[model samples]
Target: MITFGFITIHPNQENTYITEIARHSDSNTIVYRFIPTAIDPATEKVHGEKFNHESGVWETAVFDIPMYLYDRCFYGDDPLSIRSQPIMNWLKNRPYSTFIGLGLPNKWEIYNVLRSDEELAAYTPKTIKASSVPKIINKLIKDKKLLLKPKNGSQGKGIIGLMVTKGKVEALTHKNQKLITKSFLSKSEFSKWLDQLLSSRDYMCQQLLPLQDVDNHPFDIRILLQKNENGEWIEQGRGIRRGLKDHLISNINAGAEVLKYDDWVNALPVQQQALLTDGITTIINKVPKLLEREFLNLFELGIDIGFGIDGGVWILDINSKPGRKVILHSKEGKADELYKAPLQYSAYLEKQSLVKGVD
Candidate 1:
């Protein structure tokens, strides 16, 4: 039998999703879930939970590390995240273990690679590391507005929008799912605030794009791409994610709403619809191939594309460890396929390994 593992920082994280994946797993496969910190380096055993298919419950167990692993760990600045980093690095370097998808690097590194691609350059936004407070302040003054994002952030967290107008500066960000806006009467005050924020963590700054709808709600097109059992990349689904009116981000975790892609596109003018379709198709075709070539092998990607008010298309973000909320909300009857994806791909990888005489 083939053993497949799912690793996360918390035991309860993604419980439902992992359970569904286990339930849909094939007869030859068994699923286990573990926190990366639970692995005993001395014994090469992991103290974790195993899914009992018949009872549909996860039970405590200790076993050897699985041959194939699906890494779902999302790290933050917390202590637990700090401790697990070196352990995960150790696991990644283990010769006996194989990850379903070797994840991508930070946002700054990804942005540089994407901008260098000739075909993707037009869609890519110009980004700079927020390493200098004075430089960021100058850029904000010159551009009139800037968007700040954590270099390693996900789920739309740690994003701030800054706008300068008539000697006053305004900043907007989300905190605990609520929009918070603050105004500074002088550039000096805004500079101090920017300095403090940039010091807290690494960040990237970009010229703010008008990625809002007619009603002023920020929105983006989220497309999910995954590799099939044949090891070929395929479009799993696409949907529209719209944030609250005047919000800076359209991440679902930030309380955004999902809209069916077809419905949203059909509401636009015929010419505009064609333009968007072509643009989306081009990105869907080029991004995955380019990323795999530049980085490592990847099993899936969640590509976020933004359409500006000026009819410009922009690639806002690309995530390797993507969430399925947009697809589950926008597309019907995809639950089974989504659940089976990991298992099917794992089986394919196992087959390829055996063909190469790998144990």
Candidate 2:
């Protein structure tokens, strides 16, 4: 019997997708416990939400530490908060309890690691931590355009695109519910804006690439990769996320629409399509192994790749606790594969635990 414990920020047992994972997990020996990050250590149990498979409704239930804990907690800016910190510490000390996707990694950390690796360096874009206006200006002068994103940002939040021309500096960012475009002709004004943004959060500067369709709608491929029952990395599926015309990043949450993957690739020239698939396959073969060595116990990853008009492919992002927007937007069969992945991977972990006792 393998008991899977899912930990998230909130207890929303009614979430159909959440239940779908548990529902598919129903079996004589398989059980599930949905836990929130706010844990009470004195009780040695957490305030968890468990699905009542028979009743078809989730009810309040106190749960002890299960065989494996899955970290699905979405900590926006601060991955480790006071509330979730204790839970993480406790899990670290628990000998019998194991965790999958233990913690979210920083973007800059990933870039630095990949930058140092010989094989991955060729695939990594030039990325660096933005500390001052001088550094930003230098990148703009060299690259002409720059993209600034928070190191810990997720779902395309806090992304800014800057284009430098002769006498003007135009900045673009998504705010509230719409895209905002601001122009700074004065050097003083632009520097002030840069200072404020840098102080607010840690940012990374990357040389912006031209990643848009012929109609100027920015788009990218979101690849959903997961570890299967055999504990091997597999490409579950892929989806195309197209942003509004002129929008910088192709984040599905940021007004991006899902397009059929096959349709998008088919529209491209036959030779370009071949290059696209070959580049993606190269990424899939290399990224997972490097990441597993850098971190540990990762069950899945959502890789965002950008393709330029010149038939160039670049890795845009790597997410440990990846969002399901890509898979959910995929075909019905792909959605089923996404839901089944968690349970399947947990069983694999359970088998590994039996072979080598959890430390």
Best-matching candidate per lDDT: 1
Tens digit per residue, CA lDDT, model 2, 139-172: 7877889999898878888899999877799999
Span of ten consecutive residues with least summed lDDT in model 1: 186-195
lDDT of 1 by residue, 39-96 (tens): 9988989999999988989999999999899999999879889999899999999999
Report lDDT (Cα) of residue 195, candidate 1.
83
TM-score of each: 0.98, 0.92
TM-score of 2: 0.92
User: Backbone clash tally for model 2?
Assistant: 0
lDDT of each: 0.92, 0.79
Model 2: C-alpha RMSD to truth? 2.5
For model 2, the superposed segments whose C-alpha errors exceed 4 Å read 29-37, 77-82, 357-359
* CA RMSD (A), model 1: 1.3
